[model samples]
Target: MHLMSALLISLLLVSGCKSTTTRTGPIAVGPGVTQSQSPSPEAKRYTYNSDIYLDVAIPVFNPGFPIDDDTGHVDYQELDELDIWPQLRRAEAKRFAVETKQALAKTKAFGSVSVVPNANTSADLYVLGTILHSDSEFIRLEVTVVDSSGEPIDTEDFEHQVSESFFRDAMNQDKDPYEPVFVEVADYVYELLTDMSEQQKQQLKNTTLVRYAHYYAPDAFAGYLSQQLESKRGTQFYKYELNAMPAENDPMLQRIEVLRNQDMLFVDRLQDHFAVFQHTTNGPYRKWQRETLPEAVRAREARSERNTKAVIGALGFIAALALGNNSTSTSTAVAKTAGALGSAWLLKDAYQANENLRVASAVIDEMGQGLDLTLSPQVMEFNEQEVELTGTAAEQYEQWKAHLRKMYQLESSAN
Candidate 1:
C-alpha cells in the first residue's frame, strides 16, 4: 500500500492531474546566440554630416512563399486544404520593406530614402530585405546593403520572438511590436554610413548616376565607368571606377539627368502607394497578431506538456506490466493494480492535452481568415502614358523599366 501510494502520487503530478499552471523549463539557445548583447532595441533619430548622406533605394522584398510539393509553385488549393495563406506573405514582404524604410527615414541619418517598386532603381546605396519566416509570434529577415558600385557593404539576419505581453500594454498598441528588429537594422546601417569618407560617398553617388545614364545611351556613358569582378566577405560584386568624366555640357548627360529626375518623382509616388498599403493592412493585421499570439503560445505549451505526459505514462504502464507478471507477493499485486490505474489516468491526460492543442490551432485558423488574401495590380504612368502594371510586383517593375527603355530609344532615334 505504501509503495502504491508513492507511485500514485508521482504519476498524478507527472500527468498534471491537479496543478493548472503551465510548466516552465530552460530554453535551448541558438548557434548565433551571444550573451550580453545590446538590450531591448529602440529606434533613435540623429542628424549626421550632410556630405555623407547618400541616396537609398529599397525594393519590394522577396516573399519566401512555400511551394507545393508537386507543382513547384504556391497552390491556392493546397493553401486552402492546409488553412494557410501565402497571399498574406506576399503582402507582408512589401509591408516589411516599407516599415524598414520608415525606420531608416526616421533616423534622419541618410539622404532620400525611398522604396521603389523594383530593384531597377540606381542609387548611391541599396538596402535589400528578404522575409524568411513571419507570424504573430515570430519573424525572421535577411538584410543586405550594397553601394552603387555594386560593392557589398554589410548583411545580417535579424529575428524577433514576440509575446502576447508585447501587445497587452495599452500604450504600445499603436506601435509595432517588432520595432526593435527594424531599429537594430537601421542603427547598424547608420553606423556603417558614419564610417564612410566623404570621398567614398561622392564616388558612389557618381557611379550610380553614370550607371543610370548608361541605361539611356550605353555607347556614350558606359565608357565613363569601368567595372571589375571582386570578392568581399565571401560575396562577389562588381567594383566600379570612373574611367573619365563626361563633359558637363554634354547634351545626352543633361537629358539623362532630366529623365532620371522624372523617374525619381515616379518612385516617390510609388513609395506613397506602398505607405498606403501598409497603413490599410496594419490595423487588421495587428489585431489578428495580438489575438492569435496567445493561442499560438498555448498550442506550443500543450504539445510540450503532452509529450512529457506521454513518456511518463508509457513508463508507468511498462513498470506496472513487469510488476504484475514478475511478482508473486500480494502486496506487489496491489502496487501493480495501482500502477495500471495510474497509467490509464496519465494517458488520458496526455490525450486531453493533444485535444487542447488542436482547439488552439483551430482558433488561429479562424483568426487568419480575417485578412484579405491577395495582392493586386497597380496603375503606373509617365510622360502622360499609362499602363496597368500586371503580375507580381517584380514582374510589374520589369514592365515599367521596359517601357522606360522604349521611351528612351524613341527619343534617341529622333535626336
Candidate 2:
C-alpha cells in the first residue's frame, strides 16, 4: 500500500513540473504565448575567384490563415476571435520577407538580396517563406530555398519563442525581437550556398534568361529546358535543367533579354512597396506585442498553476478513497470528508484560473481590435505615364507581368 501511494505521489510531482524558460505547447488562437531567443553564429561571406555572384529574390511570405476547406477562405468573426485579421496577416507577410532580406543582405553570401514582388521573379536563387504562426511572443516559419535549376537547397521549419525580458531588452538594444530568427535563417542559407561550387552557381545564372524567356514565350523557349525525375525515401520529385543556351548575341535572345531587363527593372521598383510596409507596420506590431505582454504572462502562469493543482487534487481524492475503504474509524471518516472537500475546492480554483485566462484573452482581444494597420498604394511610371498601381500588391505585379507578356508576343510576331 505504501509503495502504491509513493508511486502516485511521484507521478504527481513529475506531471506537475513546469519550465519557466521556454514553452512549445500548442498555441491556442486569441491566447497569449511565451518567448525566447535563438542566436546563430554569423559566418563570413562566401567568395570565389570568379566575379559572378548569384542574385537572390525573396517574395512576400504566405501568411497563415486557418481557412475553411469548404469555403476556401476565413470567416471574419473567427478572425476577430483569433485576434488577427486579413490586413494584419497581409502586412506581416511582407514584413517578415523584408526582415529576412535585410538579414540575408548582411551575410553578403550573394550579390544582392532583393524582396521581389513576384514569386516567379527571374533570379539566380529564391528564398521563399510561409508564416506558420506568429504572435506577441512566438513565431514559426516554413522556408524553402531553390535555385533557378529548381533544385531544393533547404526546405525546413524555423521557430522562435521569447519572454517579456526579451522584448524589454530589444528596445534597449535597438533591435527587433524577431531579428534573431531572421538572422538564424540567413546564416543557415549562407552555409548551404558556401558548399555549392561556382560552376553550379553559374549554371543557375545561365538558366535565368531561359526561364524568363520561357515565361514570356513558352512555345519559342520549348526544348531549352528539361525536367529530371528523382526519388528520395520512396517519394518522387522533378528538377528542371537547361538543355541548351541561346547564342549571346542572337537577335531573338537579345530581344528576350531586353524584355527580361524591363521586367527586372519593374521588380526593382517594387522594393519600395516592401520597404513602406515594413516601416508602417513595425511600430504598431511592436506596440501591440508589448501591450499584451502582461496579459500573456498572467495567462500562462495561471494555466501552469491550474494544471499542478488539478493533478494534486486528483491524487488526494484517490488516496483518500483507498484509506476510507479499509477503515470505519471516526477519524478516518472525517479525513475522507475533508479530502473530498479539498478536491472540490481545488476544482473550483481551477475553474477560477480558467476565468483568469478569459480575462487575459479579452484584454488581448481589445488590443487587437484597436490595432489598425494603414497601407499605401505604389505609384508606377511606364513610358513617361505615371499610373497608380491598383489591386493587392501581388495582384498588381501579376497584372503587370501579364501586360509584359502581351508586349513580348506582339514584338516577336513583328520581328
> Which clashing pairs does model 2 show?
35-161, 35-162, 35-163, 36-161, 36-162
Residue-level lDDT of model 1, residues 58-122, one tens digit each, is 88787765678897987777555443456566667777888889889888877799887667787
Candidate 1: Cα lDDT at 335: 91
Off by over 4 Å in 1: 1-43, 66-84, 227-242, 310-354, 370-396
lDDT of 1 at 136: 69
Candidate 2 lDDT tens digits, 358-385: 7887776665543332435666554454
Task: Give Cα-based local distance difference scores for all models.
Answer: 0.79, 0.75
Q: List the residue pairs that clash in candidate 1.
A: none
lDDT of 1 at 253: 86
- In candidate 2, stretches whose alpha carbon ends up further than 4 angstroms from where it belongs are 1-50, 67-87, 167-173, 228-238, 314-331, 369-388
Error of 2 at 274 (Å): 1.3
Candidate that scores best on lDDT = 1
**TM-score list, all predictions:** 0.74, 0.77
In model 2, the worst 10-residue window by lDDT is: 367-376
